[model samples]
Target: EIIAAIEGLMKDPAVGHPLKGKRVLVTSGPTREPIDPVRYISNHSSGKQGHAIAKAAAEAGAEVTLVTGPVSLADPVGVTVVHVESARDMLAAVEAALPADIAVFAAAVADWRVASVADNKLKKGAGGPPSLAFVENPDILATIAKHGSKRPQLVVGFAAETEAVVDNARAKLARKGCDLIVANDVAPGTGTFGGDANTVHLVTPDSVETWDRQSKDGVARALVTRLAEMIAKA
Candidate 1:
């Protein structure tokens, strides 16, 4: 059955996984930054791409560890999933499952979290709304990319931007210190958020390669295949 599945996947070119003996780590979904016990801030990440990558990695015969934020999807088969809510929690989870061959950061983590969260929900005052302060969240991709010894052989980050998609992605690639950045525009009404399809540009220090529009699963397979080749050459 497994051989049949692999042969079927190989025929597609975009859906074959060849990552045997590799250890892959993936982060997915939207991280919620809590403001109070009842309120929080988050984005609209659905985790489709990240989850698909994890599934593809497992299919490629890799041992996968998926560190994900809050989402409503079932866990992928043959992947070890670690559930987390906040950006801090996600970072801690990723750190705990380190020494991986590859790391993919696909989570739309909140850039800032409330400086101080109230123990209870803040009540609406008669005078005005409650004021909230924010602080920067941990830079998980950059952190792992810059790790001294425990760093993965390949570190990939996702950049969801509205303007200057490729340029911004290139900037993020340099800024995050990751090996590659998978960038896509998530402008309103683009269907990139919570959508199955994607148009991505693989940004690396050497070049930016744009891919044709395709399903997230196809993208995952192609990416895994590329990473496997790179690891083999390394």
Candidate 2:
């Protein structure tokens, strides 16, 4: 952390815009799957990490487009923000923000949504609980990553897991066909869902690099740096 702080302080502001001519797309927060007008199925993602990445990208001079779900945080200055609710809505917004030089999938989109939505709020009744039919939501990460020509040059993904963090991320890296997977543990008590910091492992096809715990903003800045290097190498 000390070294990271020193590196950050040492970075020359004049050379900050390494991605000056680049375009970036980032997704944040958890998509809500509505069960009724008053109830929904969603995770605990806070959009902190995603928002930080979008902000860092803009600071690097990239033309950034942020597609986010319901979050209380203010929109990042200089970023084009697209607000979405359900997973399907998020998918549409993401598809619309295309042709990015780099794409980051940071949102914890719901895997399934209620097949049939209730028109009004559900109330207590003799029937203990109402049965719900769920259907798979669109695979946004894989869809964008597999897009032939419209696919971004660099695709990044995130894996929030309770166990086998690196292993799961490695599998996801192949399954989703993304260039990188930022893996972290979001199991109960990790405070990752709404926390300010993260400890992540950068998983790729060839290797895994574990980074020390740091602020979400710090991870974003460091990620942007790595992305610049990756794109340059490509």
TM-score top scorer: 2
Per-model TM against the reference: 0.92, 0.93
Displacement of the residue 170 alpha carbon in candidate 2, Å: 0.6
Residue 213 C-alpha lDDT in model 1: 93
lDDT of 1 by residue, 1-234 (tens): 999988888786444446767899999999999888888899999999999999989998899999999998999999999999999999999999999999999999988999999999888889799778889999999999999899999999999998899999999999989999999989988899999999999999999999999999999999988888888888
Clashes of each: 0, 0
- CA lDDT of every candidate: 0.93, 0.95
Pairs in steric clash, model 2: none
Instruction: Show where candidate 1 strays beyond 4 Å.
Output: 1-17
What is the per-residue lDDT of model 2 for residues 1-234, given as tens digits with 9 covering 90 to 100?
999977886685536788888999999999999999999999999999999999999999899999999999999999999999999999999989998999999999999999999999989899888999999999999999999999999999999999999999999999999999999999998888999999999999999999999999999999999998898789
In angstroms, how far off is 134's CA in candidate 1? 0.5
How far out, in Å, is residue 147 in model 1?
Answer: 0.4
